[model samples]
Target: MSEQRVRGVPAQPSAPDGPTPKRLPAGGQRGGPPWMGAGMPAERSLNFGPTARRLLRRLRPQRLHLGAVIGLAVVSVGLTVIGPKVLGYATDLIFTGVIGQQLPSGTSADDAVAAARAAGNHNFADMLARMDVVPGAGIDFPALGRVLLLALGLYLAASLLMWWQGWLLTGVVQRTVFQLRAEVEEKLNRLPLPYFDRQPRGELLSRVTNDIDNISQSLQQTLSQLLTSLLTVVGVLGMMFWISPLLAVVALVAVPLSVVVTGQIAKRSQRKFIAQWTHTGELNAQIEEAFTGHDLIKVFGRRREVEAAFHAKNEQLFQASFGAQFISGIIMPAMLFIGNLSYVAIAVVGGLRVASGAMSLGDVQAFIQYSRQFTQPLTQVASMANLLQSGVASAERVFAVLDADEQIPDPAAPVRFTDPHGRVEFERVSFRYDPDKPLIEELSLVAEPGHTVAIVGPTGAGKTTLVNLIMRFYELDAGRITLDGVDITELRRDDLRGRIGMVLQDTWLFGGTIRDNIAYGRPDATEEEILAAARATFVDRFVRSLPDGYDTVIDEEGSNVSAGEKQLITIARAFLAEPALLILDEATSSVDTRTEVLLQRAMAALRSERTSFVIAHRLSTIRDADLILMMEHGRIVEQGTHEQLLAAHGPYHRLYQSQFHQAAGGDDPMPVAAASTAG
Candidate 1:
């Protein structure tokens, strides 16, 4: 498939027929109207087991901290479980005091207890014996005060432990996220160029920024909470069984039912959560595309179309999100209802037991409290299922990036050049982005040291792909590319690329001072060297004109500067690198005619002692080239000097006649010549 050239840089090649732009269907995929589909990519299914395992593996580095956090959570939950029982003890003390005051004035304690047992009030009698009762005397105020104080202390300690656990967990979560983000950034750098070509930048950014943030928040808020919930359930259940096994059995019945309900709801809701984020990523992609191409959209009068597209995506996102939240939302209330039913049943049965002296009032109260505690955690855990699902989905996205295949790895024992002179050669090289379609086949060329090799080709003739191969950005499907007689694949990528400098058609500059941007390739460059490179690129005139000169900070993508100025700064960066080989892919396309002349003069000087490959549409720019390789269909159709090609009257001859000749005010003898040659 032929690739389209954007100004000067060739677009990545696609299928011969090209990918059909996905159109909004007349009736959408689901049989709705044209606007219903939102054109979103299909959502990927979640494989929870593997993804969860991979995510947990990332926490290996923080295992010690995580273990400590779990320990603290256990301690905090233990105190929480003990605190309620202690409060029940205080209640028993108050009940005993009140009952002692109500005893008949003349009745002896032993006789009263015996009469209570005879009436099947054995539990009441047991309580009477435990109380320090004096006939017609009030309750023991000191003992009740002590019990209340103990309950108060237990609660206070539980609160303190919870606060401390949260504090420790926050640091652990932040650090883990920081490490995760760092690894993702590193992985991006290592990934092959093809990986990027297949995905949108905004979607990848969503994974790195948004997905990671979700995982971080879940860890911070939900991880400890989940652990505490489990611990509370275990501790509360133990206390319940200790108080009364029969009551514990009744409470346990709700456990399986809650699990069944939660599982059924979560099984459906998880997919929706995955779809929600998928749609969210699509929405982000749309916004990123619109903002980046705002000028194009305005110029084309596509505002209505853009808005309609965004609306469709927004609606889809809303549907997915609402479905996920609504389904998951049933868990908390469902668990609550089930929990309350169990509580009511336990209350009725326990009340009967207390009346028949089968259980004490305080014991029943404690059992009821334990039942609440038991169900409370179950409800909490059911609620957390949603967060866990969302987190797992986010984690799956993040891990997908981390697991992406990296660029063809560097050799086990890489070679390097010492004092290298750039003499590149392609030996029977064959490459194709897709194996089904071969682009460059048996392509062979030699670029001698310190010579300017100008590659002239129609779009999709593999001009940019050739340079990409030289830079080792894409590996050859067959054969080898060598630099100064050393096979490039055997050389360390850093070492090979260190000696090669590229100034692409699209200039990129980070947010930094002009000097910093210029010194990007060589961070340790001196002020003198920076100024020299800037002067060579004719950027010094503009730099000196600015109030801050070299210190002027450029906005992101150098938006603060004009396009032409950004290109000059990038050229200055390349010059500062002082590489042995230089690839100028339409480097001067953005500059004005006058600036182009100055740049040509500077390039001429730089090209004299360094190997350079120039790709440009302007034939006049390469008139002085040492060798010009005319390419067609990824083959070298012609080769030699500018005069040699023009005299040959071949493809390059026609291109010059139609483009350069017309630009120079010559009569347009063949207006269709360029297109014919391109075909």
Candidate 2:
């Protein structure tokens, strides 16, 4: 595909019911205001040489196009100056020689009388008195025509050149934007998960979608405007100096003043812009949260509460945006006021020069026009200062994400896992979500290859944390997790992840067909493989019962499918992956008893040749597990076969008894297990 094409376009034409990957968090999104501007001034001290160079390199492909556009700008700017020069010359001719010429229309006496009055020499009545006042000398029709034609041609050429520049500049900007967007997306995929944990998804979304968009828009506007403004400024100043250096000097006093004023405004507004963007992100986050939890809000009759929360965030966004724009808006009127003052000064000075004959009337007129043209660019430059600053801020934001160094990089030399036999071992691994709060302390476990290892625990027991470690989602604070005696960190993340499959309680289905959903884990799988995988998970029966069978589209997050069907499709996807390690985290929680039995059979088939980690609310699902690790407050309190634990009549036994009796409609508390395994 061309660079203009959006990236991540699928390679195959599949049934459109596939599941998409979860939206990864953006870097700047973590724990901050949503509407923050690009880069902090403090961050500029850090090296961005690489990012600048990279941006320049990306623009290199469009260098030829940019060069052509700039060449056109040069021609256009030349005409912009020359067009007024032509008019000035014509004006000079009219003042010095044209009025006394014979009238082209019917030679009326009144016309001759008016010419005589304009000349103040009665030359029209006494033709021989002044030889320079003859009709051809005064009129010069052919010369006039040539001057008009030349101006017209220059005007047309300049217009055409401007058009071409505008057209080509768009191509350059859009292509660069497309490439940058694709690269940013790819980088997000490669970035370590911990980077996401700290940032908010809404903030990241604003950066990627809003900030990057701002950068792209700013780049286009700045490139075109900066080039044209610079060229026009230079050309007009050159003409002004050519006409009268004194006037040129007077007009330019405002240039430096304008710059100073613009800089002051920029300095003041930068923080505000940052704050505006941060608040916008916060507002977006709140809106997303409220919308996503709309059902909960309605069920709880908290619509008014949600609206109040929304209004609070909206007001914050409004204040920030208004403040930022108000500061930026100060530039235009200030520039125009300065420009008007410069115009008045130039006119007063030039009028004196014209009266004294130090300069011709035409020369004074051209100087006035040129002075205005020169300051026009200055005014534009001042106005666009805001856009440039915004761009830089946006660049800083985008680069902040690109420059984040807090990710867990794989070892320099990654180990190859040719045939992954998933024997996971956590050797004395102690972990904390935060250093001040210990979540799992001195945790160690060994799960043999091709065995179902069940972990039973209440909320916050760190069962999920164990699976996360196995997947290397979060690095251990102090411990090593090895797979078949090799450190998992040494393995390439993609290679390591490819060997594992997971089915979460929150099943995510994208806008695609059931067939596509089933083949999501194996993109290149055949239709037959998709159908077989679905049948294994008992998803095919439901899919086939649908109006269009597997061909039916599951748009809007598979809203058309039942929750149980969504779970079944997720199971089918995992089955298709056929990984060496499978994790089922409350996988069957949404399914009914009949569906649960079918899901168990699917799990049995998937786990036959793979090590499985199961976190189930229903203890019966894991009763036959090879090892049941009973966890409490981040430590494994009991570990053994279900029967052995039951026979031991300790922590696991009492807990199982309470749950087992509860299933039989009894209410009771069980004996507590020791806090830690050693205890």
Give the best candidate by TM-score. 1
Model 2 ranges with Cα > 4 A deviation: 1-61, 99-137, 663-679
Q: Per-residue alpha-carbon lDDT of model 2 for 524-586, expressed as tens digits?
A: 888888888888889888887899999899985567988998888888888888888888887
* Local error of candidate 2 at residue 571 (angstroms): 0.5
Instruction: Give one digit per residue, the lDDT tens place, for model 1 in 1-679.
Output: 1111111122232221112223221111122222333464544588878887777777788888888878888887888788767777777767766776787778777777887889988777776665545555566679878877887787788888788888877888888889999888888777765666556656767888899999998777787878888899899988888888998999899988998999999999988998888787777877887888899999999999999898988898999999999999999999999999999999999988776667677788988988988898889889988888888899988877787777777899998678888998999999876566677889998999999999887877878778878877677889899898999989876777778777877787778899988887687889999899999999998889899988999988577889999999888888888888988887888899899999999998877678999876667788999999988777888999999999999988878877656546645543333444332
lDDT of 2 at 655: 62
Clashing pairs in model 1? none
Cα deviation in Å at residue 474, candidate 2?
1.4
TM-score of every candidate: 0.91, 0.85
| After superposition, candidate 1 runs with Cα above 4 Å error | 1-43, 115-135, 660-679
Per-candidate count of clashing residue pairs (backbone under 3 Å): 0, 18
